[model samples]
Target chain A: MLAVLVGSGAMAQEIPAEPAIETAPEPEPIPEPPPVLHPPRNIVAQDVPHDNGGVLNIQWEPPIEGVPVRYVLEMAGEDGFFQEVTRTALTQYTVMQLENFVPYRFRVAAVYEKGQSMSPETEPVMARDHWLKLGEMPVLIAIFVFGSLLLFFIQAARRGVELFVRRISGLTAVEDAIGRATEMGKPVLYVPGTSTIEDVATLASLNILGEVARRTVHYDVKIICPNKDPIVYTIAREIVKETYASEGRPDAFDPDSVFFMVPDQFAFAAGVDGIMVREQPATIFLMGMFWAESLIMAETGASTGAIQIAGTDSVAQLPFFITACDYTLIGEELYAASAYLGREPMLLGTLKAQDYGKLVFLIIMVVFTLISVFSGYDAASLVRVR
Target chain B: MKRRFPMTIMFLFAIWGGISVFVGKTKVHDFDNLLRNKLLLIVGAFAIILGLGSLIFHHTQKIKRKARFWQYSYVTLIALAVTTFIGLGGGVRGERSLPTIFGGTVIGAHDGLVYVFTSQAEKNLFMDEPSRYADPTKAVLELPREFETDFNRFEASQLREEIHLKHTALQLKGQPIPPMISPVSNQQVAYKKEFKISLQQLYEGILVPCGSTMFAMLAFYMCSAAYRAFRMRNLHAGVLLVAAFIVMLGQIPLATAFIPGLHELRQWILDVPNLASKRGIMIGVGLGASATSFKIILGIERAWLGGGE
Candidate 1:
């Protein structure tokens, strides 16, 4: 019985030791020491000027060790303690607004989840406030060229130098259209367009109107103007009156013919259409800054069997005018038409100078296109060398 | 001589106004209060009278002569009388009250005009079925009764009807319903019609009709005008004819489709030779305009201001 009691006590002690052993299984195999991360390679630095004094640019390639790694770009000043600029998965970083003309040392380190490896510091790049230095030369060159051209033209115009101007088909047709109306014994309808007087297009229209008035006075043709702007209406009456007086036909001029239509665009268009349909004008002159109403007006004139001559600077709407009108002035040509018809010396000189400017533009475009084409072929090699 | 001196002064003022941009450094904020000042309000009030006067003079002449489409004059006269009566009869602190019947009528008409011409017109013309009203006659009959309830209630009910119609139409047309309400009104109202007509309405109702009519009318006028003007019995006319034919055919889609080369040719004409010529002309125009502007600024181009020789 004493022997049995001692065996029972030893068995209980062995059972407790077995429970402790079962609680802790083999420890995780020490996690394989996590693949060693090499530092980022070929670090480079450059100076960039910005509004503030706390930025720099750092660039580097991924580590050659072929491990997945991110980079941390760190910058330091003369104080020597590095502050992280950016933590990025990218190979490039632009450190911005660094202290002006101050030296900054930047380095990149490769990091894995386990640990980080250091890269060699890039050559110290100075932050500069001299940003204007880069852009100044090109801007100066452009200003000089543009200013000189402007001055030359102005001086030439002031000196009364004769400038050659090309004839616009639409302007040339103006007198003919008016004459045709005179022959048909029908009134001429002139719409200065639907834009407000503040628009430059309206000014061009007025200039053209002066020419049309001059012709109408000479031919003794009745000209009816339907205007959208009250200001334009007032101006039209004055212009027409002056033209008639200048042509020695002031008595023949009818102030009532210059009428003010509604201020609304569509209302004005409808009113003008009513005039076209009712009056059946032998000729219609649509000159000004027109919108979608251009096609409507042109088409209405076409239907009325009027000799339509439309001129506008709206490029998108030019196609409709071209299709419907006898002669259409495209874009800048409207401006040119007025100048040609007006025959003012200042205008002629400016026209000649602008032609030379356009020639310069054409040459530049051609050279740039050719260079772009040639450079595209070997761009990869050039990029590698850089 | 008295008129001439004041006119000259006004001309000088205008010239100064054009050059004010170069001379003055005033910020837009400085002008904001001045834009809404009492003097400007007075001037605008007078300007409105002038506008009404012009409209009256024009329609009166048409009415007197019994001109073509003279019947339209009645509509113009009635519109003018109603607008003038509303505008002139009402005042802020006068015999007429701020919320006078005339004033309210004017405001209601303006708002109603936009809704009818914009929303209802589209529903009437383009919609497959009237969605808001299962029966439009019922909605029409209810309109007068709702309007008689109270001014505010009437406006609210009318607005609701517009909303219902707009939403239902959009739903029927398989379009998403648009949320419509006055920004001043806090209520979030879903409209029956999705399309709110604006410039598109003007395009459809006015510009399209005018343009199509103008285009068709030109054909008849051109026939007569061409018979007289296009006698290509001269060198200049011959050149014009050729140029016209080239441009006309070049612009048409049918020509471009049939002859692929014509498209390139047209582009060349527009971009190269045409652009070059146009530029040459523009330079002249720019110079002329600059000179004219300079003259105006210096009070030389005084003809516009009705001054000078």
Candidate 2:
């Protein structure tokens, strides 16, 4: 019997066994439950108003049940693929610098601890430019009033109406200074400030330079003007040349008189100081905007014992000018210098308009103070720009 | 015509500038940006070229005429040339060398011994017992006969320090080896780009210090000016002197401590009276600037255009 069992085992080993038969084709495996997800709702995208365009205000509501860890905002592409814009904890976001005229769709997803679910996509919204900015109405009205006053005064001057302008001592001294330079046989040094042409102070200084150049020509006195900006140098050179030509002494205008020294502030100051020490000009005119170098240049001019006249709209530099200069045109006086020097009626009219604007400002200040005291209203806020 | 053309352009641009300030429209901003960024940038570039030409012409004329301080022009021109050459040729960051050779790494340990997988060429030499390579710069196989027997952590560290010292000496000479695998530590040893001097260093070391010195000179100038300005020649001078004294005294801790409520008093002066005067000046300046801008825009102020009516 053992030999027979061995023979059967040998036979089983020799032959390939058939496939085993199953009892109930194996019990089917249990399926996992679908994950519970909470998504944000009521996603909205609106065009931001009073903008240059390309801005949208996106807002969303949180999920109904549980609070989300955060929100994921997405913008849809042309292929309907959602690209993540930002992940934020807040419900609202401002998307800026989008294509102005292009329509955009947005979706928000509530990111929970377990999983995230997306909200219904918002309707297509397009950013558009508004005709006028409503927030700037106060500024617009103020500009209009000031402009009207200016026009009115200009017309009045054109009609030969007399205008009174206070004498600026600095401007009155300009001719005398040039005459002194002529007497001393020394050049008159003029610094037209260390600023670009874009600066209004530089423009004012240029206007004043024109008048100064004309006076220099009349006196036959040499003038030396140093500039820090290349554009200002060009303009100043032209003004000097043209002033000499108009005075019928074009040959007297030396092209090298008005020159660009340097662009760097302290470097220009050092150069100007060197020029002052070496040349020893009889009179120095410091005009336009100055910074820390104001004291440097002014002190150097003082050391040379020159009669220095300074004019600037820079409030900080005013003290330095007053300290080191014999005559100073403070604040608005610098702007009125051209009119004062030339005695032009139209220019004087503009000066009158500026004075009127100041009067209006004074009245507004008084009214605002009264309203604040009596009615507890923030009158300042009414004119406050956003 | 030359004057009229520029005046007309200026007038149109000035009006546009005013509108651009108040308008939030895209078209207005685009045009404004175009003028400010693109157009102005182009004009500025041309202006710089003209400025350089002017500088050259001025200096050359001064040198030819042997004007006062003509020798200084040579210094300026030479400095400009040298700076330009250094910036363009040597590069701003300065020169650098190739990386150093990689030494071996400690692979594993045998019975009372640590084995290192050395270089490929060295290993090949051991396997085949070939002749030395022709290149001397390549790392040499220096496996001593007594290496296995006399090897210790101390000798390995000493060797590493010796190599590091050599590299440091090279670095001080501005010839730094970039990076290499350290033999003893079995890690990378990196050396930063070391040079004698860089453009940025030159700017910081020379230019910045010069600027600071000039700025520092202002304090002395201010003191001198203050002495002259604060003299009691008149009522205005006395008022200025008193105000300056109070402000200066208020700034010092010892003075503030001695005088009670000195800080508050100073604050009141600054916040109320000083601020009121400053604001008044600012308002006047603003109105004047607006009026000037209006005159320029309306072509009423044409003196800026070369003494025109």
lDDT of 1 at A230: 72
TM-score against native, each model: 0.53, 0.74
lDDT, candidate 2, B225-252, per-residue tens: 8889899999989987888788889999
Best by DockQ: 2
lDDT of 2 by residue, A1-386 (tens): 99999988988775677898867777688898866787888888999888677889998888888888999999974567789999999999999888888888999999988889989898888888876776777888888999999999989999999998777788899988989999999989999998889989989999899998888888888898988888888889899999888788989988888877778788889889988998899999999988899999999999999999999999999989988999999988888888888888988899899889999999999999999999999999999875
What lDDT, from 0 to 1, does candidate 1 have? 0.62
- Write down the lDDT of every candidate, Cα atoms only: 0.62, 0.79
lDDT of 1 by residue, A228-284 (tens): 877677677788887787777779988668877777666677788889999899999
Q: List, in the given order, the native-contact fraction of each candidate.
A: 0.06, 0.63
Runs of candidate 2 with Cα error greater than 4 angstroms are A1-45, A57-124, B84-205, B252-260
Which clashing pairs does model 2 show? none
User: For each model, chain A TM-score?
Assistant: 0.62, 0.79
Root-mean-square deviation per candidate:
13.8, 14.6
How many backbone clashes are present in model 2?
A: 0
Chain B TM-score in each of the candidates:
0.46, 0.66
